[model samples]
Target chain A: MPTFNKYVQIEDKPSMVPAGLEKAITAAAAKDTRIIAVLEDMGFPGMLWFKKNCPERMIECGIAEQNAAVMAAGLAAEGFIPIINSFLFADVGRAYNQIRQSILVDRFNVKFIGREGAWGEPGISHNTIEGIGSTRPLPNLVILNPADAVEAEKAAEAMLQYVGPVLLRQESSPPPIKIFSDDLPFDIGKAFSLKEGRDATIIATGYMLTEAVRALDILEKDGLNVGLLDMCTIKPLDDKAIIKAAEKTGAIVTAENGTVIGGLGDGVAAVLAENLPTPIVKIGIEDEFSQSGKMSPKDELKEHFGLRPEDIAVSVKECISKKEKLRKKRK
Target chain B: MAHHEKLVKDLEKKANQIRRDCFEIFGSTQMGHAGGTMSIIELITALYFHHMKFDPKNVDWPERDRLVLSKAHCCEAIYAALVELGVYPRKTLGTYYCFGSPFQGHADRWCTPGIDYSGGSLGQGLSFAIGMALAEKMKSVVKDVNIGQGGFLQRYVVRFDPLYRSYCILGDGECHEGMIWEAAMFAAKYKLDNLIAIIDYNKFSLDGPTNEIMNVEPLVEKWKSFGWWVTEVDGHDIRQILDALELASKLYGDYRPKCIIAHTIKGHGIPAWEREHIHLGRGAVIMKGIEEGRKKYADV
Candidate 1:
């Protein structure tokens, strides 16, 4: 196991992803009785709140993830919107076939809440980094990775408003800093520009958006202006935003708390490579399976994975230099 | 009970016709699941012709009872039955498995009419049926408040008659999947009395015999242990199947789901094809022999 001394201390924030999701579901259930929440063996604190509000709609489906997925599809088939809650590895990884066949193929109105991302300390088994990659190829699935509790709540409500299958990935650890205001306009398949710059663009998603903001601050201190874009929706990607970013800033660096292979980085790169060939650098876990061991602090893990602010600054500088070299070669 | 004999005879004739139609369809396609399709002819007939309430004109009627063919590969029997009921055109049967045809090899609700759920992957329909049953249970409760001048007359009337039931036909081989047992535990725990599951215990699977491949024996006891009202019957006998279904329907709202283990042969109608481990591709050869004027069975 690798270790690092550099640790980014997260503030003691009270808001959490599960709490926000539960609050959103409870509020939505009051308006629409068709909303049903199905739980696996994993206990969600939101279940109690939902049960207290809508007692008859709670379905405790035990530890069987496969059955839970298909049961949700069946409920959706009968015009009831079912939200299934489970760990990311268990729900999206284990019951992938059921989600693909029964839910996505039929376009059933089902919502899946996959808790715990690459930031959790419960070891690699509980920490899921490839959920977005695994579910990205499935047709008719809307994938959302919320940056913080506020975005999580908004994403939950947005999923309810949408009428098809959705996979909303919720991080296990809460972010110390708030990224979005209370009145931020959130929509599916849309990207939000946090900061504008012309030198290079740092497009990030999920928890990495916080790190991207910090990196942008670091670059600004050096008098380098770097643009920052928060991509919440992975599938049905905001191609227009990405193309605009690439055209405005000739260099791009994609960051995500997932694997670099088929996650947000590859998704952005695929569009940019086809639309406009820009010099891009990806910042995420390389091609390897993460291990389970002693828990490390979030900052140390970021340093260990080369995901710190300084590391991102280094990649952004490299991307800018690469773009310069390509320009000179063209001349 | 005097008219029971006539009902049984009529159902038997319909089942025989469906079996013949299934074999002919498979013969024409030269590739289809005839064994399992033939095994569930009587059960399908009993449900579509006698027990289940469905309107051929309106396939999406909310009050109509739903049937999910969990053994989806055996869709020929369902297609034949639908054609007989006029839900699908008679000429569509000839276009089975052809390009751009509505009649696919598997039971896809998106492609064909009267199919409640799409099923090609097994071990999923039971859970889907439980979902529909749960929906019906939740929708059936009606809160009626009639306020008079003196006081308010509030009555909670649960109309079970209008509430539709969900029936699923599963294959014995499909039970080998772990999802089936997971669904079973869930259905029993919720006490979904509106859901009924009928397993076509045809003994043979795609590769070989179910017992030799993977024995799912003591099926009745297993269902009983899972807290289901278990019943065993001769699947080919229309009266026994109908009686089991009727008993299952009567047990609605009892807080316990029903399971009927129907013991049946692999190739029920044709004696020559019986005892053979027949699947999709294997049926075309036997069907070809029948079409080539090889009369192996006098009755067929």
Candidate 2:
């Protein structure tokens, strides 16, 4: 399959805790009776912390996602904090309509914590690469896809107080351990620039942030100073990030753990296409269904879709070089 | 009960009036549903004028009962009934289907003051009604809790946890929707006795007749399997409809949510409104407009 030499190991069978999420969950649920986790009573301490604080507040309506969505709506109507959890398949498959009608339409303060993406060896139906794009443009649905554990915790704390429907997508594999602190407050509709460059801007959200950082380093080795942006929030995207990234780099390359169509990559490209018209390349899955092989084929699947870090670095370099040539021609 | 009798007696005339109102509303839009609205008038008449416990003055009274209209396209009948009950100015009927009016040829919860849930999507209203009923029951007062005496109910004056009933109205066409079965099975499982779901079993749907599309024959058997107290009535007959509903309300100890299938013909009240293509938006063959909408109503 596809191999990332640095880290490529599954959690013995299926242990549900995807790294840094445990830490973030512990911190976010530290104080708040209104917030509780609805995950199965597995070894995940994050769930344990939630049950400890908000015993009555944390609603567990079984493993049924549809019931969770409906009960969340009921709780929201009655002024209760409701958080629902599951893998991509359960949330998007059964509870899609329920989430649309009851949760989103009612504008309930409900939290849908699930893995954001169509990545890794999660199989075909489990590969929710198109999940974010499909859920976008749903009127008041606010989707925030955090890159790592710290961002996830910050987003969770911020969304807990926000009075709207939030589709919080967390990475199945935590990238950076501590990207932020209690000091750098996480807000909605905002993006952060990690590094400044003059060649190309690489905008990435969710687990793709790690790849964007790596791609930038690869470009730096090639004497190209590439810009990097962490697009934590997908819907109500950080337009300022796109404009700033474009003004500084002149060309852009976008990436996310979702389909290239309506994912963060498109969100970035759509902005540049309209405002700046920059030479941009998107690194994500093309329009195709993921394979349903026996083993989890995350890397192989990503490679098949041309989402490798090398592919991203090469595309950004090529785009920036092409833009430079076009400028020269214009001159 | 006495009011119910009067409604049953005047049912035929009122049914015609409602049918006329439906046609009139449709006429205003030049293109709107006719068959379903015509069939639902009598049941609507019985529910609003007689059955449902609500005051026109206090629309959102805490304890006031509510109706979940699953078939929203028959909004004309609902609007007409609301107006007839003095819940709002009858003048609102004139604005039916008018540009930018609250009346959008469908039951808009915002526009129509008492519509509990906006029901554009079919088969979803019953679930919402269940939530409301659950809220009402859960929010009731338990003033004093004595370990030996149980939770005491304080008999007070204002803000009485008004014993509200949830009436969910469904269409025969809606029976084909899979979600309706889910709602029915859910009602049966929960034993939600306070929920009264009435189905307007008008055989004719938008495309010809329902039998041709999806024959839900032996409908009562289906509901019985779903663990419901099924009651069948001639949809146009007010006495039968009222009697069945009264039987349902008075039923004690049986916690199964009741289902009243009012077997009806689409466009039942109005003769012209139901025949062939005329009722199915085949050009305003008749000035089925409310002013002229009166004649098409075959009340008796």
Tell me what fraction of the real C-alpha contacts between chains A and B each candidate also makes. Answer: 0.53, 0.03
Q: Write the per-residue lDDT of candidate 1 for residues B75-159, one digit (tens) a residue.
A: 8899999989998777888898998777888888777768988888888889888888877766644654332221121222345
**lDDT, candidate 2, residue A69?**
58
Q: What's the true lDDT of residue A112 in model 1? A: 88
Q: Model 1 Cα displacement at A97 (Å)?
A: 1.0
The window of 10 residues in a row where model 2 chain B has the poorest summed lDDT is: B147-156
lDDT (tens digit, per residue) of candidate 2 on A174-193: 23333443355678998877
Alpha-carbon local distance difference test for all models? 0.80, 0.66
**lDDT of model 1 at residue A18?**
68
Could you report the Cα RMSD, in angstroms, for every candidate shown?
A: 5.9, 6.5
Model 1 iRMSD vs. native: 8.5
Candidate 1, residues A199-232: lDDT per residue as tens digits? Answer: 9999998878777877877898887888888899
DockQ of every candidate structure: 0.36, 0.13
lDDT for predicted candidate 2 compared with the true structure: 0.66
